[model samples]
Target chain A: METNMLPFMRRLQGATCTWLVQIAIRENAENLPCYAPMNIIPVKMPITTPPPDTLRCIPEFVLENVVVLITIARRTVKLNMDDADVVNLLAPALTLVLTFMGDSSRTYNPHLRARLAECLEAMLPNNEDDSSSHNNISSFYREQIFKTHPHRFQLVPCLLDVFVGIEMTGQSVQFEQKFNYRRPMYVVMDFLWGFEEHREAFTSLAREAEANMEAVHPPIFLRFVNLLMNDAIFLLDEALGNMAQIRNLQNAQESAAWTNLSAQEREQNLTNLSHTGMLARFDNILGRDTIRTLVRLTAHAPFVFCHPTLVERIASMLNYFLLHLVGPNKKNFKVKDMKEYEFDPASTVLDICRMYVELGKNERFCAAVSDDGRSYSPKLFTLAESVLVRIRGGDLISSLRDVAARVSTIAEQRQRDEEILANAPEEFLDPIMSTLMLDPVILPSSRTTVDRTTIARHLLSDQSDPFNRSPLSMDQVKSNTELKEKIDAWIAEQRGKIAHTSTSSTS
Target chain B: MAAMSPSERRLQKELMSLMKEPPPGVTVDGDQASQNLTLWTVHMEGVPGTLYEGEKFVLQFKFTNKYPFDSPEVTFIGNNIPVHPHVYSNGHICLSILTDDWSPALSVQSVCLSIVSMLKTTAGQFVLC
Candidate 1:
């Protein structure tokens, strides 16, 4: 029962629960008749003003929850709660909320709704919110409560009814009324998802209520996504199941042959599929109309797909899928027709390039892809150029052109460096011009062969030359191209001498 | 312990530890009613003898599934703002621990202590200087 933790909990509950505990202990001091734990209830008292103890304990920030939990817990220390007891307490509790909900639409039903929230709040596994709660229901106690108790608590679905309001019954909730009722519903969802048993039902109810909530409410599914994304039980696949993109994706993914294919095979098939022909591979999974709808949504309201920071994620995922139809490091993903795809890779790159532009609404995202100035293949450059031409984002277009131009220029420089290397002398064999410290200033600067690596090491502590002991920086060194030509000629002469030696030895 | 992901397990341990022996002037609202450990709302009280004493602030922590591996997004929320050099008016803290100085060994408890000490140091300087 963790009786040692009791004092800490009592301290946490502070004055309010302490006052209740003091009264209950004082009244039952000599030991009253002990009842079976499960059947016990709070001592009935008039629903009147303040008890002297409660009057003294009330804090400025009201936490009415502690008083209610202690009221219930005072009767029985370890509450052996069952489904019936939960339903009995909470159903009546909800009714009180609904009745109060009628009288006060302005302030809302704070008095009773807070009590209901408190009741649910008390049953949670111990934490800070429950710190103020005196009930201190053990984790084991809560587990048993759910294990023994079936779905008897009707309060959750009832709250949904109040939340959605006649939507289930085909009656519309008034626009203003819908806005006001969200808080209690939010509270109910928060409490319900805490229980392992209730999460599925909550998600299912969310699915059913989604259609009705479109106009008045932000998609309630997002709340669950926000909470459930980290949970192993709720995969990203399941979270996005209702979205057309995921639905179409799932249809394509669940294909028998597609599922059975090895990852290499799947990567091949998807990469090979023609842009319009790509619809054929997915057609086995989803209808043409569904794929069309999925594409349309992406083209239209792309923001609907954005879950907090998922814009980048979806963009990267599309790039990956376009590149290799399978997920990163994922295997056992198999595909058929391994040998047959010979169309332009640009088509596939361009497929995702559109969304890349769409996602480039974030200036930072645009700069990362567009301004890198790395040369792409002629195919990708054509695609990028055409994409830049289409997107019309001013910053992006100039950057894309700049990156393409820079990459080509870099490519030309690299080719020149290679040509210079083919003819270089033995003295210039080292790439960093490490063998000779030829000065860029063109004076009698370390004409003797000096390894630049040694100078670089010295420059780490002392940014000066080792030999002359003068001020020197790595930037000050230049390659001795004359020595490079001499080395190349020497290497050619050495090769000729080796050829002459081999022929003479054979004779 | 092995069953939970590193982030989940670490968060669980931190949650229990935080509840058991929380940092002074710091309390996390134990409303894990979402059962999602990735997000937390922490309540902090300005140390009693400080310039910002008697003030209450709430900090929202958003942790990804790759947390510890990835740093949590911690930002202050509420009407009250502590006028400190390291704290932005927009509630983005300029603390190194949140960015370049982050290490996986640092938990919610340590972060809370770091923030408390930062505030204390600032308060001490404000008074003495």
Candidate 2:
């Protein structure tokens, strides 16, 4: 446990191959199998617990040991790619590091753990050389790792903690940091993609965690959702920032200074602008990847993605990005400003809309996105169509077209609602927001009626009647059943008018 | 229209009403606000008979996506922020309605009226000080 023992162990570890021998003995006890590239042998090691004292090291020391072991495993695998026995020798050591990931009491650095995970995947016996043996080794290691903790999954959630920090602080780790801050996220998606069991386990955990956001220990999945949305927001903001830069440079080129500049200086300026465009293009790639992960995650669990606040947040992001993609009047989606500087966010857009389209395919998710039972954000539907039309043909096109058809149906219903509102008496509207009330509830203290959603949202932050400033809670509000009946009848009347008008026009 | 949030719909209605029948001494710059619903600027001229009479002021309103449920950030924005007991040099106002006393029933028009009246009464009382 002594801090100085770490450096001594590091030196001793370097001096001898004793660490590998110890790991081999440990693996022998567990009967864990190791696979050579084209050959297979199930190595049997009896399972035994390490000494109690060995498990009692300080957390920081454990972290250093983990880092050292991960480096060795990575280098061992890379240098011995053709030597399956050498690569296979590091399996037990790698699993031990993974088990270290299960120790909840200690916080392992996410970047290091991510590297360890990537190294584990790389160390998997070559898939083509020995398929059955690869499955056995991978499955056994996964079971051992999952058995290390009560929850059965640790590494991914722990890795996601870094992203949770980014969401809360609103500052992402810069791309320049060693191993880069985003390495864990990329590794997480890659890890999940490598193993189907991991994806299934992750989807279930995400659903469980989502249902309990206010739990004492908030699940990393909800924060992960926030992180994905935040990434989209920040990436789009970066794109907008780059667009502004391009505009400024274009303006500068048009200004009187352009003619005054020497030819050499002009070339330098043009090069700098193109470089900026390249950065924008790089951001688009990152954006597209993030959206792909988001879409995949959403497909796994629509309920988690359709959580009310998240649904709203995602809709807002789509709205902003789509508006930018398709300029005003829905034309000018693809903009080519400078040669070799083409920045099209269409792929990212398609990914996001693809997510929306997928979510819309589910009835419950559609209702969640639009609580009023009409349609999801009409503006989003409008904006998406503007872009979807420009796309020639693809699976995304057919799916998005389906969403458009649904939106039109909802639009007709909405038009009927608007007609009802136009004829609605002032008393039918929510006094606070001035919208036609749905599920009106009367405040006891203020003697005012507002829509249920409006009041519920208001009470979340401040438990007071907005009209009277008197302390109030949702439980005290009474439903305005009489007004509800009147509004229903009124809407029916408007629907009749719409039905007549539509029939007449068709005939 | 279907996708517009409750806050957006409310703001749209308020914008139209304010444009069609603006209150005395107040006019909203509609064209500027047409770009985004969450932010707006209103032009206010000092009410007659007040110490700030003939003085012009600009108020900026910033609404969150959750607007009616949450109070907008209201501040005196332009060069002629009023000199008053409740007005900070940085254009922040200390009026109660801008904070805890705010009601969802209040609109941009009501907030503008409150600021104008605050300028009149507060500046009147402190004019001789």
Candidate 3:
């Protein structure tokens, strides 16, 4: 069965060779139209003379195939294949003859010479092997196969692959050792063939090295890796034409996706708002927890927050919720301050207590109390007293009530005083009332009534006694007039001082 | 120290042309007596409207043996540290152009301008290395 298979293999090899040769002839003839009939003829030409360009056959292909077969045979022999088997194998036999022709130094037909060089190269050992046989075959291939078919398209890639494999295996040392005993022509051929065939592979290996660089740990290795990657990139760039088709396709797809999604999203948002009642649903959807989570996430992923669109969305949402919660009049509350627990109602109570403490330090409370006294309203007094008590207890509600009481008291007192003045005689009330009002110790209510006469008299008499002592009713009139004048003068002086201070400070 | 070679003299003349006329808040200076004109000392006034405003900084530039063919080694000098995430406490700047993005087309003057621009345009409290 093995013997039967051998003949069949030989036939298959012959058929493959015939097909490859035909393809090469056709391709070459296409470039040199005059040699079409010669390409159809399979007759072997003499190796001594250069083939005429008119023949139009790629001699390099035939030579390369022969060298490749010879190398394969040698590899098989190393594994203990019989010499008779190699001679009988059509592919191997053809390869050996081509390799010999390529190895010969004699000048021949230019095309045949180049083809011979390629065959010799195919038989040459890679940098990984550098064996004597490999060196000899490689030099022969360069001179014969490569020189003849320098422009052979397939030969370049095939040679490159062999070279790349050797480099990747780290067998340069073995290659050098083997090549040392070989002819200079063979050594040079091995290098050239290795570079041409393995250019891409070498580059890829280099790129892999660069990708795995450890600058400190392996400086030399890193440099080597970078060099490999750079060479690979350079070769690839030349091998592959500009990839405009792929880029254009990618761009089109991206644009389509973007536009389609954007339009769909806009429509979806509008529909959602209409169906769900925009404001109410939006508030329900994004609860306090959700907003808090968003803020936390934004803080963690600052890059997201850096996006203007994202920032605007968050800001708008925050403003919307705040406006709803605090009404327009209280908008200033949001800007005024931020406390850790202010977001919690319980903590807001503490802030209120602090505010009341601040308000208590102002003397405005005195005016409220005096106004309350004049009205003598139990309800107003009770409210004020309750607020004061609450404030003392450090309750925020107390501060709120205190503010309300003071504002109401001042307004009510002013109204009542206006009503009284409207009914009373100007001369009778104005002079006495104005004089009493000027006294700091006298309340507005006390100033209107004479029932607190003793207190009023002491207050009026203690200060320089502007009204002179006199006997009866007439003296009382004069004393009252003089006292009113003196009181008015004192009030005017106080007013002037206050006005000057305010102006100076404001400027 | 070795005397400046002819090539080094040519490079220095080329570098001088590339240096910009100092803008409102930028300055440049170089060592004159050094044998290698590739090494330069640069001073810059911080651009206003930045966190580093009103501060002065110094930088050192050491071109490789293959100037124009390779990038320069730039480092900050003095104590005025750049408080940026990309800028190390030791004053080593981690800009792309100084490393992977470096091209032969880039000049010392353009690099300085780019650094100033980077400081100006960044709005965050922290920078990205």
Candidate 4:
């Protein structure tokens, strides 16, 4: 059953559309659904006896064709071809790349494949009207490649493996370029920059891959994510008094939001508070989105989006943070030693604490805490909670305590307001309601009665001041003493009046 | 004595604040009041019942022009360097923050607290000296 492979190869060399039609039709049978956004690939094409010795040299053939395509693409000005034409032209070659990715048993030289990348980067549509090519390629991936490898999920991880040399920890894996593979993803990302359509494919794929990984090994995946989260947590912890620290990175908010914090005004940021603060504050900036994506993927214990895996992930993260709280680690966690990770453990504990409290009643986390078989400590939740109450540990106790106290006060105040509304004249009721009545001791801002913890959490995620619509800064918030005194007096007065009324009613 | 740089000023401020509200079991050496802002002497009493309990250790904090920018040179001296694996007999401490993990955000107060915490956590009997 020998068919002529040379003539089709020649046509591909000449950049004729007829060769594309032939490959799309004939190759589409075996590599069915491996074409454009049309056919969906079900499972990785089975290695049905290597594509003959002639087809084994396809990468070299593709390289030669790319060199010619480069010259032709550069020469043809009025070559009004859309993304479909380009995808069809390169569909057969891309099949070889996908096939290579699928079968790890085959010999792969990442640097050699870099020539293929150069071709795709070259073919990235330069004009605005034809900008849909990146999306088209992404769709082609989402439809077909998705079916072939459901667990492999996103192109990002594979892209990272190719470009960053990260997921290269497997047996029988040899490397020609054992150094840096960060360029491939960045080059592709750079090409797809500014287009949300292209980015979405990555985002969803990343979500799927993370979900699958977490579902398989919740503890390992979280440990990896927690370690990676170290940088963003450190940045957040340092951003205590000055929101300017992190806001400047995301380039978020107006310049007025940046309070020109002088050296004298060295306000303590989240790190100054607790390592836990820094970790939780990760909800802010690019790190926040990434963490949210990761969290979104993992199933938190017991519910929709609350899969026990997420609980396990957080629990495992808490365990490592606890070990590293006071001192340097003896060895590396993965390839690098623990000594390489610079973080404050007690503070990291607090960050994990905040994360747990925010998650609230994660049954799996609670269950893991009592189970000794879990990594780190089975007494995880209990030990961490004890740390929160410890003053010397940092602001975890005080900050969380402040939030609890403030919440109770708000509850008390709301009850009194209802009584006032029920009994008082309509005119006075308007005035009473008109006045903002909250203890500024726990809530520093006058624009609204929001508790400090709420504001702190919000600031951790974003820089905007919710009450004033200004760039919210941690340092600018000061305790309003006068307001606190008045709110206290008002609550006292309302309580006394209620007492007197109850006595009179009984008499 | 060189005119105070910004680091010196900040260190001086930190020293005053630390003296006002030193962490539990830590006391600033009275003699440091008369010295230049560049050097500080602090006394830390070990916590009760732990390995370091009942021990009295003196710590010397020496700062450079890069004081806050660089971590201060901190070590135990004058009788009691800690008898722990991480602490050397020569009075030098093996903690990373005093060297590699130092941040400008960290003050003398926080550093003292951390040192005290490290001492309280000493469980191993591998005393070097």
Candidate 3 yields a Cα-based lDDT of 0.41
TM-score of chain B of each: 0.86, 0.90, 0.80, 0.86
Model 2 / residue A46 / CA error / Å = 27
**In lDDT terms, how accurate is model 1?**
0.45
Candidate 3 Cα errors over 4 Å, as ranges: A1-11, A17-72, A75-507, B1-7, B14-29, B73-80, B85-106, B122-129
What's the DockQ of model 1? 0.01
Clashing residue pairs in candidate 2 (N, C-alpha, C atoms within 3 angstroms): A28-A45, A28-A46, A29-A45, A29-A46, A29-A47, A30-A45, A30-A46, A31-A45, A378-B3
Model 4 agreement with the true structure over B41-116: per-residue lDDT tens digits? 8888988877888889999988885455467899899877888777889988887778755644467787888877
**Ranked by lDDT, top first:** 2, 4, 1, 3
lDDT by residue (tens digit), candidate 1, A1-507: 764454444445544333332332222123336321223234322112223332233342333454364346533534434322332333223333332222222113344334444444344333453433224334445444444543324445444434333222223444323323343344445555566556555545445444433222344443223222222112222222222232343446567767788999777654544442343333222222222222333444445434223333343344333323212221222223322322222333344455544544544343233222221232344455554454443455554455445545554544444343444444443322222222212113554443433333334444444345566665666555565456556655656765687799999
After best superposition, candidate 3 residue A413: deviation in angstroms? Answer: 99
- Report the CA-based lDDT of candidate 2 relative to the real structure: 0.62
Tens digits of per-residue lDDT for model 1 on B7-99? 564576577778778888888877661377888888999999977799998887889865664568888888876778778888887777787
Best by lDDT: 2
For model 2, report DockQ. 0.35
Report the number of backbone clashes for model 2: 9
DockQ list for all candidates: 0.01, 0.35, 0.01, 0.02
lDDT of 4 by residue, A162-189 (tens): 4432335445234322212222334444
Models 1 onward score TM values of 0.24, 0.66, 0.30, 0.31
Worst 10 residues of 1 chain A by lDDT: A231-240
List where candidate 4 sits over 4 angstroms from the true fold.
A1-82, A99-243, A246-285, A299-361, A366-507, B1-129
